[model samples]
Target: MLVVKHLSGEYEQRDPRTKAYATKVKDASLSFETFELSQIGRENNGRADALSRIASAETQSLTGSIYLTEAKMPSIEKRECLEIHQGTDWMTPLKNYLEKGILPMDRREALKIKYRASTYTIINGRMYRRSVSQPLLRCLNTEEQHQALEAVHEGICGEHLAGRSLAFKILRQGFFWPTLKADASEYAKKCVQCQLFATVPRQPPEEMTSVLSPISFAMWVVDIVGILPTSMKQAKYCIIAIDYMTKWVEARPLSAITEEAAKKLFLEHIIL
Candidate 1:
């Protein structure tokens, strides 16, 4: 039996304007001509003359010698071989085979994903592993690296750094805790950014007063304010309040400062 083996090489479609479709091969651009019996006398009792005669009779174009080979039947367990003819397109057959389930779809998908994932450019001449989350080339600076490290650390702690308000605070202050070396707990505690921005300030408990203030409904403290408006459309008047003991301040907006309106606004905000 005669058999042919396909070679592995880069293949590309030819341009219609520059190349003839009839002469162009699918998947490859190289020209290929079928040779005469290239193998003979390598099999048991194989005659070189007989093989050459057979080749001549089969193709009628004998341009090469006839070599012989042992008849090794293809194994049933072996995967189907893809015959990539020289100067002939193999993409159609390949696509057919893939669509018909001759080729494993899952394996092909996995291979495609692997190829896409591996297609990444190096940064700063340093070989870092490719990943979807990896920073782009232009953004690969010292500050970006610090941010990335911080993000990774935050992610490990089950938090998303980018979504957190404290992220801007931490980045603006340029804070980094030495978690990898020395005492991580102590380092985190001493981080100035973490203390001033990331962490909420802890207020000492207010001292308990022995006497209680008399209850006066709607008789609440209020603030009045006026300022010139900027370019943006915004009101100038504002009000703020503070608890007597807690000292926590709350600010609100006010349109007018009439005595009756002020009393009603104070009652609505403080009492209600």
Candidate 2:
């Protein structure tokens, strides 16, 4: 019996002696190699599908649309700092002190706010504080002012800069607060990405203080030095202890470096 399998536009058969044409043979069971042909067809289909998927992925990557997501918006151009008028919740207290001449009953409290009369002024129905050269530091209750300052300093416009730079950027954007420098410094220090990539300073920020060991054995540095030429006792490793101020030195040799040997040396020579 013989059968034909067409693959890649070519006829295929296992036995070369088998005839090429199909014909009915009497009293003989005919079987086609359909299973092998099907297997080969499946393999070709799988390869084709994989190639198609790879092509689709490459096309999407080039077009930058591999997955659907929120449409990105363009960044706004840097603009002049905008000022907020009074009527904000944070400004209520200062507004009251300026418009009504109201003072708290406590003498200390009254004295504390006395500078407000001179420092603060009403402009276009809003309360503002006077400052030299820089924009007026608007008095806001606490949270809102911090939020506004942070939005400019560390939000979308921010590039996770250093403390001084962050504060200066905030100031240039016309926002002022009492602890602007400290706040910016703290925020930048806590930024996870900034900390991971922060550059170490060339010089120490503060002068280093010398450590003084008042007496011998007062301050000791201990380390393990090892793998020397083995002697008669088979002691090839050594533990060294040095005094910081007095320049005192002590060493113990061991055949094999072990915790028990090191502890025994410390207790016998150094401790006792």
Candidate of highest TM-score? 2
TM-score versus the correct structure, for each prediction: 0.18, 0.41
Best by lDDT: 2
lDDT of 1 at 105: 53
lDDT string, candidate 2, 1-272, tens digits: 11324332245545433332222221122354332323335545786666557644645455443444343542232346988865445355556778887777888867777765677778878666687776775544568566865676568866778889888877776666667789778877788878787787779889999988888788988888879999899999999989998888899888987889878977999899
Collision count for each candidate, in order? 9, 1
lDDT of each: 0.44, 0.67
* Runs with alpha carbons beyond 4 Å of true place in candidate 2: 1-92, 202-272
Once fitted onto the true fold, the runs of candidate 1 whose alpha carbons sit more than 4 angstroms away are: 1-220, 228-234
CA shift at 49, candidate 1, in angstroms? 88
**How displaced is residue 236 in candidate 2, in Å?**
40
